[model samples]
Structures are given as C-alpha cells and as structure tokens.
Target: MEETWNEVLRDLSVPEDIATKWWSQIMVQYTESARIYHTMDNYLRKKFEIYDIMVKDNISERSAFVLAMFFQHYEHDTNVYGDSIDKNVEHVKNFFKDAGINHEGLISTVVGLLGAACESGSSKEGIDAYFQDLELAALGASPDEYVEYITDIEKEYSNMPAHFYRSLRLKVLQTLLLIPKIYSTDLFYEKYETQARENIEKEINEVLK
Candidate 1:
C-alpha cells in the first residue's frame, strides 16, 4: 500500500518529501491497536477497489475523489464518531495547505466529498452518489465475507456489552433496510443491491434472535 500511496502522490504532483512524510503519518495512524475493521488493509482497501472500477469508467474529478478517500478516514476515532468527522475535515484542510496545493476547485471538491461522507446519506445524482456507494460496497459482499465483516466490526466494539451492542446493531440494520436503495449508484445498485438486502435481513434476524 505504501508503494501505491507513493504512486498516487506522484501522479498528483506532490513533492517526494511531502509524500514520504504523509505516508509515514498514514502508517502510524492506520496501524493503531484500536483499529480493527477500519484498518487500511480492510475497509479503505475495499473502497479503493470500487474506486478503481469507477476510474475504469472514466469518473470525473479523479484526483479529488482519491484525495477525499484518503482524508475521510485520516483521523478516524471509533469512540467518538461525530468528533472524528470534524477532525478529519480539519486534517484534510491542513494537509492541502501544508502540501502547498493551491487548486481551490480540487480542494473544494475533496472537502465536499468528505463532508458528504460525514453525513452518511445517499445522493440521488452526481459523483457524490458514487462516493457514498463506494463507502458501503461492503454490504454486497458474499455471505462468508459479510460474516467476516460483522465479526471484525464486533471486535472493534468489544468493549460494549453484548446485549447493548446487539441492540445498536439491530437498529442500524433496520434503518438501512428502510432505505429505498442501499446503494445509490446504478452500478452498485445492479451489482450489490440484492445481496446487500439479503445480508441486512439475515443480520437483522440474527440480532432479533
């Protein structure tokens, strides 16, 4: 992933020194002991896989999208979800400033994408829909893979009482199930929609039991 990060930074015309410094910080942040499901090797990698597909289809504002993905979770904290979003937004702004990136349009697009992520809501059109769908692509994983995802997430919340955790998890599943479409984009909707619904229903049943 270091190699990939470096390549992306180079493609974006970031200086070698700045890229190296950013990579070092990313390594430390992502590998922290508190992170489980949210690790670079897991959640972020999955999202990037979807991003790659979008790239193949020639998505606009590619650089902005990639940068948004990186900075969205650059400062994540499981203990305080709300605060994490604000911190990540601030960190992203500071990163662009420190990197001496002066493209106001690119910066605005990246920041807007990050803000959309913080809302955790779906968009009806535009790249924002694709971005939101990418974040939730995991829901369409095969049964076994989905189970693994649930297990990893459970590990992340192990400090909470099992019953309380189940309650929260059930509510979340129910809320998602109520959405008109779990994935916002046509690509994601066609590919993962059915499986995602099935997965959510099965998990909801398990939580109820």
Candidate 2:
C-alpha cells in the first residue's frame, strides 16, 4: 500500500511537503486500526438512525446532523478496540467530498424512502424508484432483491475475517465495474461516472496490486 501511494505521490511530482501530506493522508486510511466490522456496524446504525429520523415530519438541525452522519459518521464506541471507526469514516468523508456529486436531491429522496417503503417501497418495488431518483446503475431495477443483496453483504462485512476486509472492498469495486452502467440515470452517467470510475479504478488497483 505504501509503495503504491508513494508511486502515486511521485507521479504527482509535487513539492516534498505536499507529497508528504498526501502520503500521510493516504496512510491514515491505510493504517486504520479497527476491524472492518466496527466500521460497517456504525454505518448500519447510522443508516437505521437516519431512517427513523425521516419518519418524523420535523427534522431539527441535530437531526439533520444525524443524517449527515450517514455521509460522515465515525463510531469509536468501544474501548476494546483501539481506534476503529474514525479513520474509516474519514476515508468515506473524503470520498463523498471528492466525488463532487451533488447529493442535495439524493438526500431528500432517501429521507422519503422510509415512507415509500409501504406503497411500492418494499425494498424491491421501492428501490427501483429510489435508485432511479439517485440514478445508480441497474441496481434499482429489482429493488427488493438488491436490498437483500446489500443487506446480506453488510451482514457478511460484519462477520468476515479482519484480513479479508480489503478483499471484500475489492469485491464490491468489481461488482460496480461489472454493472452495465454505473449510473442508471443519464444525468449521473454524463456528469460523474467517469471520475467515479477513475477513483474506483485507482482504489481497486491499490487493493489488488
């Protein structure tokens, strides 16, 4: 990992200090001390919390902050583990910001998902509409099945061996690459898919190599 990052750092050909900062940032994510389960569990908890938060009509600032946590939440809730959640959360936060994807509408649509869960929203039915709104690839076409796929995977993430976390992350990257189109909606496809793919490819290469 360090070697790859060093290669990237040198490729950028920046000043020593700038390269050092970038390397430090990359290494911070690479050296996260927590088992992936803790990070995954926090992500799940935040997702559930956001769902419950959306059930209410009035969303307070704190509530919105809670929602924001889905985008940037770190869980260091255990004394047993050293520092599991913060670095992982930091990596995600950086990813979202770097993705440059406008999430405003996507955020609003997700909050509406819990409500839509009943109508045609039973995971399968609802997710197609949801994904169309978010414009992720063909993932939403079969909503419930996709939901189950994700849920099952999250479950696996929580239980998988610590050494395999990188492998699991790679698997997910490969899955996305295999999708017919990364963004189902033409808007996202046109605007963000290329950069998104490049970012994923970089990470995928980092993990595999």
Candidate 3:
C-alpha cells in the first residue's frame, strides 16, 4: 500500500520528504495508541478523492492540490472532533483558501468534519456518532471517548492473544463494510463507494485466504 501511495506521489511528482512527513505523522496520529480508527489505503484513496474532485471542480491543478493536502498541517485521520475537529476544519478551509477553491459552503459542511454533525439528527445517530465523531468529527469528539479507548487498549494489549488480535482486526474491517456506505456526501458515495467496497472486500478475502 505504501508502494501504491508512493507511486501516486511520484506520478504527481510529489517530493519524497513530503511523503515521508505525511507517512510518519499519519502513523503517529492514528496507529500509535488505541487505533481510534484507521486504514492507510482508505486515506490514500481520499487523496485520490481530493484530486479527482479538484479536477472536476477545476479548483486548482490536481497535482498542486495534492501537494498542499499532502503537507497540510492538520491531518486527515480518524480523530474525532474534540481531538482535532476544529483543526481539521481549519485545515480544509485553509486548503480551499490556498487552492482558490472559493466555495464558501464547503467549510460549513465538510464531509468527515462538520459533516458528522448531521448524524446527530439521524435515526442512526446512536451508532453513527461513535464512528463519525471518532473518525470524522475531528475536534468535535469527546475527550472521554478518546481516553476510554486508550485505557481499554492499554488494559487489553499486553494480554491480547494472537487469535484475539486476528479476530479483532477482522471484526473492525467487517464492521466498516457492514455500514451502508463509508462516505457521507452523495457525490462521494455515488462516485467512489462501489470501488471502495470492492477494495475492502478484496482485502478481507485475502486475509481469510
């Protein structure tokens, strides 16, 4: 997957160090602790989404937009709002500002950022909130939830037997797929969901094999 990510970067002529910085920061932010929620291929695909959207919108040259997001200060990760939601919001705003996207409404309803706020009013809010806030809301998520996950992982990691580890990993991936769709916006789901599901299913099949 790193190779795929690197190849995308290279094809775009992204600097090697920029990729390295993004990689290190991503690992530290998402996988270092309790693994709030993560998937490298997904994130890389997001970069793909960003590039594809920019191309469609004509906001900026796709490669340039990719470079800015690749080195964006606030990460695009699985953090809930309270953890870095505001920062994530700010980051997207800054990206648009820098890229000359000029779409004011985007900041207000950024998918995976303030967009999760919508889940609060939906019938599925109970379940959606856990993942949305944890993975999407950025700084909007509660500190308590983050802390609890860390505490739980700490207690469990040392004694997590090999089989349990495999089961948990499979469970997480399966749970993500079980969701109606991984993306929120109609545009993204319509354009990317099918491919995303295929990628995820392929991964699961490989693991089971």
Best of the candidates, lDDT: 1
Instruction: Give every collision pair in model 1.
Output: none
On TM-score, the candidate that comes out on top is 1
Error of 2 at 205 (Å): 0.7
In candidate 2, stretches whose alpha carbon ends up further than 4 angstroms from where it belongs are 1-162
Candidates' lDDT values, in order? 0.81, 0.42, 0.45
Worst 10 residues of 2 by lDDT: 116-125
Candidate 1 wrong stretches, greater than 4 Å: 1-4, 118-122
lDDT of 3 at 194: 69
- Model 2 lDDT at residue 189: 57
Error of 2 at 71 (Å): 12
TM-score of predicted structure 2: 0.31
lDDT for model 1 comes to 0.81
